[model samples]
Target: MPSAAARPWRARWRIEASPVQVLAALLVLAFLLAFLVVPVGRVFVVAFTGAEGGFTLVHFGDFFRTSLFIESFWNSLYVAAMSVVVASLIAVPLAVILARHRFPGAALITTLGVLPLVMPPFVGAVAMQLVFGRNGTVNLLLMDWFGFRIPLMEGLNGVIFVQALHYFPFILMNLTASLSNIDVAMEEAGQNLGAKGFTLLRTIVLPLALPGYLAGASLVFVKVFDDLATPLLLNVTNMLAPQAYLRVTSVGLGDPMGYVISVILVVVSVIAMAGAALILRGRDFATQQRGGGGLARRPLSPLGKALAWSFVIPVLLLVLAPHVGILLLSLATVWSFSPLPDGFTLAHYATVLRETPQFLTNTLLYCGLAGAIDVVIGVVIAWLVLRTKLPGRKLLDLMAMSALAVPGLVLGIGILRTYFDVKMPDGASLATSWIMLTIVYAVRRLPYALRAATAALQQVHRSLEEAAENLGAGKTTTLTRIVVPLMAGGLAAAFVTSFATAAVELSATLVLATRDVDAPLSYGIYVFMQSAAGRGPGAALGVIAVLTVAVCTYAAHRIAERERSRRMREGRATA
Candidate 1:
């Protein structure tokens, strides 16, 4: 037998690493497997496994045989592609202006442009419907003024219009992020060499911001392709998501049509991600040098100002018109055969307040849980990859980023597939569980929180972490007391943003929500919009969603301000 001292060293050698650290890693791995891997795996099994224990591709074959399925798939592709193109064109110019100029209303414009980022895509659809639908404000105004009828908003065109309006800001924000890194001196030098306005933009700005445009376009493509609500709401039958939903509910659950659509969606997402990877390589301005980024503003001439406003006004009107319509509808007792409401009433608002309390409560609970999970996972994963010398650091980084490419629908399907039959071995069905929805929301939103946390951690010097460790503070203590508090603003922002989104999420919720459950606010709105009486209730719920996001955004901003103040005070004290 070894001596006691020798036995202690032997025990230490037997361990691969610290039990605490190993346990932590194992916990994370197990969580991923249970929540993500298994759920997605079940989808394939349920789709293919026969009674005789054999596999078949009957589902895929059956799906291809249906013309409706094929038509919808192609329609989805067309609509999404158009959204991608339109978003890129509009966003690129806005990004250029935001990056190059310090205008009077820059902040306001940027905020408005990014408003949709935090809001659900369907909210934009609701807004657009109020403005562009038959008997909508725009059509009503046009009919009254010109005494002529024109079908500007309906079918595929209406879907595309709404999607473009909703997602253009994605392109703008990304392009702005990219252009901020390009040396202004380079553009000034080009101008010095006699390059005029259009030519200068074409040669200099376009080439530099191409990667950002591509990144933004890739994201838009993925979003529009996976989206179900906009197309369904706008009466576009030729779309992928709606077809999938129909196959599951209207056709039959046993039909392979749903699997086929899911497979097609996965393929499309992969292609879009590939395109993003190719176009966005080495073009991240966030990783570039931070200092020396002061853009000199050149005042636009009267003619140039006129041109700018011309571009700005149309989009502003398009964006605001929907909200105006919604506002009018909310106030008016009736909406048809009248330019304005027949009578003003608060009945809709009051009625919604009385009903749907369960939906509101459930939405808050699920979102809050999901947001907390995301913050915890995000911070832990970020700390592991950035602060440690791990074996699969690059792989971890890639996995975290991979969530960006995985659409919400894909993730939802994955969750359903993996956990449909999961239990504690005591006979429990995880398939219809609220816990599953909460987990799905958490992991689906993980990438957003992770990215924000990573950015915040990057801003903090590693030496500070090291300093804390060297001072004899344990890893947990250091992380909790120092790193976490310092990164609180980013963590809080991520949580609140994720919460806002979860509260309004739809397509996946439709698949997962049970009859007894209140479902999310999205489902509630969808149910309301399906009928005439429901429209008033739906609009009221939509307003609630908007208010929810507005509150969360305000909270995030306040947290950021508090953190800033705290940092400044600490800095002065140290000095």
Candidate 2:
């Protein structure tokens, strides 16, 4: 009925998925649907449902009518916005200096800049209070010398200060990488056209790096917006995230206010992500061409060097304050309203190791499983989206990444509401099990692993796979022998990224941890920080958490470097 050309085109339009591809797609879809879509959808349904079980907007209306809810909503918005601004101010100058200039100790500065990320913002809240609180060291000194104290850790200001310091690394890392990729020719062209110094940077360099800046900014905004632990630690419960947590825990799940707050969080997250995308749409900033080099690094003059070091020294000290404070607190016998500790000892570490070693054991078990699940799922999703022609493959990728927009607190609530009634064979509800927490960690961190896997897969060029197939290898065989081996470094990195981040996760764990024995290090730290006697143990636990994350991050970096070096050697041999 059709010509030869038409027949070929029609065949191309039909589904080209292999049986293995189809099966993998279905399994991934089922997992996401069960754990992610269904749970989140359940929250939406409860938020919109009335007392009579009919669809209505009464809960939302009530939310708007309440003055407290209105205040909480605005408070969250203000904090998120101010955090972005402060984080930007800190990150931008640092990123530009590191990316656009060559200076002494540059590598060391870069490493120190990212040290903040190893410690969670919530953990840092405690140390911040110790360093900047009303009765803390800085204030004590200020009263003694300057006769005035700065309210750096007062109320909302404390949350902003801790969040900005801990999260600015996101913007710094992204912007620095983006800036490193820009073509030198663009800057030269601007300079040739009479643009110089600040003018060239503002008009050309900054605009080119905008996509990266926006990416990091949006992440900061979403992270700060849905953060539950930091605000709670600061005793600031007037924000949306804290309110949602309180309403759910204090008022029970059946109370619609928690669901309402969750829905609002999800909406705001989606909007922030969408707004970044909209701003970036239809704008192309690609400047690099084959054989072209990155932006030219300028050497700073003597005065310029002095100015750079002056800025760098203070920022480094500020960023590292939490680590210093926590370490000191852990060893301190008494450290209130003093510029120095009264005494130092190792009793807190000994206490944690002797009494609550299960916290560390539980973290390893939970986050290890979560990291493994993420890498496996991430690889499957990456293969499906990139290699297969299965219908809804892109949709599967989107769904996996959509976890970014779902707040950890919201996900915890959704999982509780959706699965609490579904009993296991052991008679315990699935939502109450430790396995569910593992799944939540996996789901929340899947986006990071997926991106890592996708990048790894992309690096293993199609030609290598094609050559394997041409030599009589089947799809599965080729993947196992050629593709996966090549992607081993990236997969390891992905696992570590997921594992490290999950190790410190507090929002979802706060909701799901039902017992002390079952809880992880994060929950232990939180419990210990609730009283004066426990602050020592809490700070000790915080140090352990930081060490765990730092180790994993270092390992990932080394693995990636080794893989890159191996590839370079292979390329040279081939040439």
Candidate 3:
């Protein structure tokens, strides 16, 4: 330790003395804005500028005055708000129960709850259609068994229903994490002081969990609001995402009006991000964290047991129903007015494989590139924030997190505005190019990898790194030999997640893809669903996307599990 006399000038010896660190920092910040911020800002510029480069508010005027656009914007907000409220109501109690108690298949249940997140939104849309559409499974069973039917899938209601089912898990997962950190000792004290049941919950549990609950709510709200594919797939024509797509594709407005809508979505997202920052201000979650321990379980009374089982069964069904429907549809030979398919076959998959090799190759290449780019930039950004004393460290953190709010459609449009017309000296252009897609995917997925890397770095103590340096290891050697190996699991997790998300990215890909190459599975599904014999092929492609994501997510989970087990074994051996 430095003496008091030398303390003021004795710096922390930040990990930034070398050219490598400086270069990495500069590359990361440039890449981040190039893909994330600059393109986003371009939306505003394109929206307000004339063809001759003059400025006007005609785009905004058109957006507000047009009946279709105004209605869609309002509808999008309405659906998002309602979905958040309903999902939160269901998720909060379920999260509390899961966090506070243990039961059979607890791990499986938790995984199942989060499974929807890995599946693409379009898959959810297809699945919900099979389960809840007119003459769908639910209606068919009811009509056949009891001569009764219920209208379940139509209009905004259908969109909200599916969204709520798919996103409730998001709220539940976040809430579970939040609630698990609440101190049980406080509840124990209250109980010992004559507080019981509802009273104890209201005064002790609820107050402590409010911040987390709100955080979950905010996350779910933003997720629901920003989602475009789900609403489109569910046939909600009057939604902002589809509306923006129409403006760019159908209305022949090019990107000016599209940019206006994208700007609005971005503004809304910024508000949500601000709310999250305010909720979490100055709170060190790691320090305040508590374990979900010491809660004793007792056999429930008969009726109580019945109620518990009832709740569990329906939630399980709700979560599983869409997936089951999609899987069945993917394999179905035909499904017109049939309770079940008349036959099952792999014909759809075969047809797609034979007819569209480009889809497979394009998706793999783009997703792979995007995933690689995301991991590299994410690691660099994490290092800059954690290992180096960058000038704008806090601002970088905020910017990274803030990307979560920018809708994918909005981001895609931003990319178009920024690089569509830029020419290279050799006559190559950036617009709709493979490199551009990779960059967009990288920047859009950066937050996930950055967050993962940051967390992973935190786990491997800095002292070990410093010790390596003191023992004659160079900075690069120390990082490569010690830090990278230690954080391999987290990096792999981030890579797999980024890959899965990129594979299924629709809104952004739609903007970037051309007929020749770069059109991914999501874009293909969207195109096929518009043709005759399209539903089957679309469902088939949806299954493929879902399976791809599932495989990657599963790989990530397995890697994480293996690493955790190894660490525990090593700890035991050391002890």
Candidate 4:
């Protein structure tokens, strides 16, 4: 720490870092304006403009007038709502079980719960066909034994099932976090007042966890609503996203109807998130007790444990089925109208690895740079919002998050429309370039990284930074030494999440990738899944994708677990 002699010389040291500060702030502002605001603004422009180049609502009117459009709109809403209900039903009980009790396989259960999030919904949809399709495993067994087969993978029902199974982890994560933070006194007091079983949970637990649950639910709804892969792959085009995709891809880029759908997606996303926000605003979630024991874990009786396992085991199997099917499909040389593969071979893996090294290399290049960009921007945005007094920082926060409101398809279209003709500094067309693709990835996944960074920053004591300043360190030095180090783990989590998600991103890539070689694993998988003989190679690529994502996810899980354990130890010592 510097002494008083250095203090006077170092006063207003913040101004000394203005160049770095100003440059970063300006860069972020430009990036947001250029990529996010401009493209979205273009969508609204095209969506609302008439053929004569004046403002009109004819596009929306046309959309509402069409039976297909109207049906797709309603179908989207129906599927999203059903997904939420089913996901909640599956998630709430498991969250309660995890939070309120200490049981066998608790740790394994948590790891499994988070696993689905790593796989893209559409990618999972492919393998899901093998496990839940009409002639798939479950239905085959049902047909053999019970003389019945459920339509698990039929139409929008299939979309909802996959969505529910894949997305329930959102609710599970939120509810578990909320439950862990609930004061033990609340539960004990409720019990003292004669509340028990579902009564206690409904009144005390659910009410408290409501905000987190709804937040998660809203996210699931938006995600399912805007998702392009699942509905398309399942042949369920009577949904808004699939409609938008089909409209834009099939008809022409000049059609205003697709932009209209994009506008609707953006609007619905904003409204959903805003509704969740409104419900949570001014509601204090702070635990009444300070630094004491949190929610108490109840020890389950033998029968209770058995019952819990009974509920959990089947769900776990259903969740794991897609991955198992993918692995089998990748290795199978011939899988047809049979219960099992007729033959297996390593040839598929070898073919993909040899024929298309670009798929893997492009993914690494694109996702790595995108992840790094996300982390840097995320840390900068978090600092600007929480640490600095920069003007318009709130708008920066808003814009970064609003990227989430924009679906991948819309953003991809926006990018194509806005940048297709534009030339780079070197006079190269921006369309379908790796740089453009990387920008999309970074912006699309920016919210996740920003949220993680902001949350981490909020946890750090402001006093720590102030001390460095008091000791005559400048803002940059202090941040580098204190804030960045403290936030490294969270920033890494943010990076991994962004990287893994972008690795499997398809909607945007589908539009932006000009050639097959420019495409990543997701587009390759989609292309391969188109052919019967290509399914093995596609599945092989998928396994590679899954393994890549799984490794990152497990690393993140370990980091989170270590952080939690450290915090618990600190809290215990303090108490």
Error of 4 at 523 (Å): 0.8
Instruction: Please report the TM-score between candidate 4 and the true structure.
Output: 0.91
Q: What residue runs in model 1 are displaced by over 4 Å at the alpha carbon?
A: 1-16, 44-58, 280-295, 393-397, 421-429, 459-472, 561-575
Best by lDDT: 2
| Candidates, ranked, TM-score | 2, 4, 3, 1
Models 1 onward score TM values of: 0.89, 0.96, 0.89, 0.91
Clashes of each: 5, 0, 0, 0
lDDT (tens digit, per residue) of candidate 1 on 5-96? 99888876564434555566566667766766555455556566554668977767777788887888788889899988877767776776
Of candidate 3, the 10-residue stretch with the lowest lDDT total is 287-296
Once superposed on the true structure, which residue ranges of model 3 sit more than 4 Å away at CA? 1-16, 48-58, 145-148, 192-195, 252-255, 276-298, 423-429, 570-575
Q: Write the per-residue lDDT of candidate 3 for residues 1-575, one digit (tens) a residue.
A: 66887765555444434777777667777777778888887888888888788998887888889998899889988988888887877787677667776555667778888877767767787778778788888888998999987776788878787888877887797778766776667677889999997698787776666676777777777777777787777768798777777677676436577778878877877787578788778864432325645333434567755666678778888888877887787788887677888889888888788887678788888888888877776766677678876666657766776678788888887777677778656565675776777677777787898888888888888998999999999877887899888889899999998888888888787777766455778888888776547777777888888888889989998988987898799889979
For candidate 4, write residues 252-369 as lDDT tens digits.
Answer: 7898898999999889888988999999899877669657766889899999998999999988997898888888999998877666788899999999999987999999999999
lDDT of each: 0.73, 0.93, 0.77, 0.88
Candidate with best TM-score: 2
Residue 355, model 2: lDDT of 97
Residues 1-575 of candidate 2: C-alpha lDDT, one tens digit per residue: 79998998998788888888888899999999999999999999999999999999999999999999999999999999999999999999999999989989999989999999999888999998999899888899999999999998999999999999999998999999889889999999999999999999999999999999999999999999999999999999999999999999999989999999999999999999999999999999999654768888989999999999899999999988999999999999999879989999999999999999999999999999999999999999998888877888999999999999999999999999998898889888888688899999999999999999999999888999999999999988887899888899999999999999999999999988888888999999999999999999999999999999999999999988998998899999989
Which candidate do you rate higher for lDDT, 1 or 3? 3
